[model samples]
Target: MNKRISTILLSALFSVSAFAAPTSYSVDPTHTFAVASWSHFGFSTPTAVFAGAEGTITYDAEKPAQSDIAISVSIETVDTFVDKLTEEFLGEDWFNAAMYPKATFVSTKVVPKGDNKFAVTGDLTIKGTTKTVTMDATLNGMGEHPMSKKQAIGFDAETVIKRSDFGIDQYVPYVGDEITLRLTTEAQAK
Candidate 1:
């Protein structure tokens, strides 16, 4: 177990961003994850998380606006902490994972919001439905990793999407149609 944790940490270290020049970094599955949540029965909130979000991001400090990102998350990897719910999400009512297996985001513009924060606008495609979305991102930290002796960066980002718009609003107000996505990633210069 210790070894597994160590490996995950090391992989995430390589995903750190924010530094000098144009650098490309691959997301560390062990560290980066996409988490989504929505109100449940108008009384509570249930969340599902996805790991193995493999992708690459290119950051150019000199021209922040020119930075680009492309990320893909496998819908089959969702962990709702409940076996039945996980299965339900894969069925026809929700994600219909058998038919549409992946969710992807491609950034069209990166607008600096000042002080290591930016608004990343892009197209989010899910279940064959595409919609424009903007994620607010904050560069939490940047510099060098002591153990790896390499430049690294970390960031937090979030966005909200209405499931109904994506054609997955099965429950509507009862189960909540709005889902909030939270993301955290760390990678190294590549």
Candidate 2:
């Protein structure tokens, strides 16, 4: 009877350990980028890249639904390739970077979609306007980093948002109101 009780207790402990709590990771700014693209008057598509994202991601491999992420990107980092256009994006007619320097996203829910994919619903705030959006996210890889030797995780996510909805309706239909946003990030365990 004593032996059976000890075995049961050990099994319970192992089972609990198998389902560990979520791990917090610090976003690696150098390895993260946010890209936005939109049609330019039916002629072509222009893309802008934003770098140096900062934030934290809480992840649970066993229970991905419990994970969440919060990140902020500086408006000043937006680069449209064209120097003149980049300046216009930061001006009052567009993002108004002087007044709102940072765009942020905070996850409200995470739903696992199988095969290391998830639908992450979050609140995105830009130029003081907050809107709820969902991104299709995939866990690209997760493990010890080859270079840093730290436990790291990488993800790629994409979503679509209307520029007009965020109060940045400069050209409207001419420049395409719908923008495709993509995020690529690698974070290390903190």
Candidate 3:
């Protein structure tokens, strides 16, 4: 090819490649978790955690609003420190893990809430029910991983949802109808 034509093609390729790569990161499961707690008998109680979670988040600091997150948690992996209670939670009485093994959250909008904080609006699906939940989040900043040689970022988010709204209202006056959730995620570049 002629020199001028070759130059044009190279420039086009570079520009195309620039937008082709989206900075993505994986949730470091060891450093990440989703914890939910509810008041027991109208009093404070130990928290319950949903273990065995895996997910990914893609973001661009330049365009903060373009960020998106997808998270999945195995319902049966819940740890309430009570064997029979955990089993019952996974049964038809609670999460129904047999039929719906996982719960998911997908972001639809992200709004800044000041001081590295944000309001992440998304649809949280549990037990085949979908509810629009706003998760308060904060970008814990970015850093370079010495071992993996990948960029990593941290985030902390929280949201509260009423269990009765999602058809998980088995507890009634015993267990609070509201569930408070907190998510701490450390994502490593993929």
Best by lDDT: 2
> Which run of 10 residues does model 2 get worst, by summed lDDT?
166-175
Task: Indicate which candidate wins on TM-score.
Answer: 2
- Poorly placed runs, candidate 1 (over 4 Å): 1-20
Per-residue lDDT of 1-190 in model 2, one digit per residue for the tens? 9999999999999999788888999999999999999999999999999886999999987888889999988899999999999999889888899999989989999999989899999999999999999999999999899999998999999999999999888778898999999999999999
What does the lDDT come to for candidate 3? 0.85
Q: What's the candidate order when arranged by decreasing lDDT? A: 2, 1, 3
Clashes per candidate, residues 3 or more apart or on different chains: 7, 0, 0
**Model 3 clashing residue pairs (backbone):** none
lDDT of 2 at 163: 91
Tens-digit lDDT track of model 1 for 1-190: 9999999998777555333468787766677888999999988889999776878878877788999888878899989999999999989889988998888889999999898999999999989899999999998877787877777777788999999999898878899889998888877666
Global lDDT of model 2 = 0.94
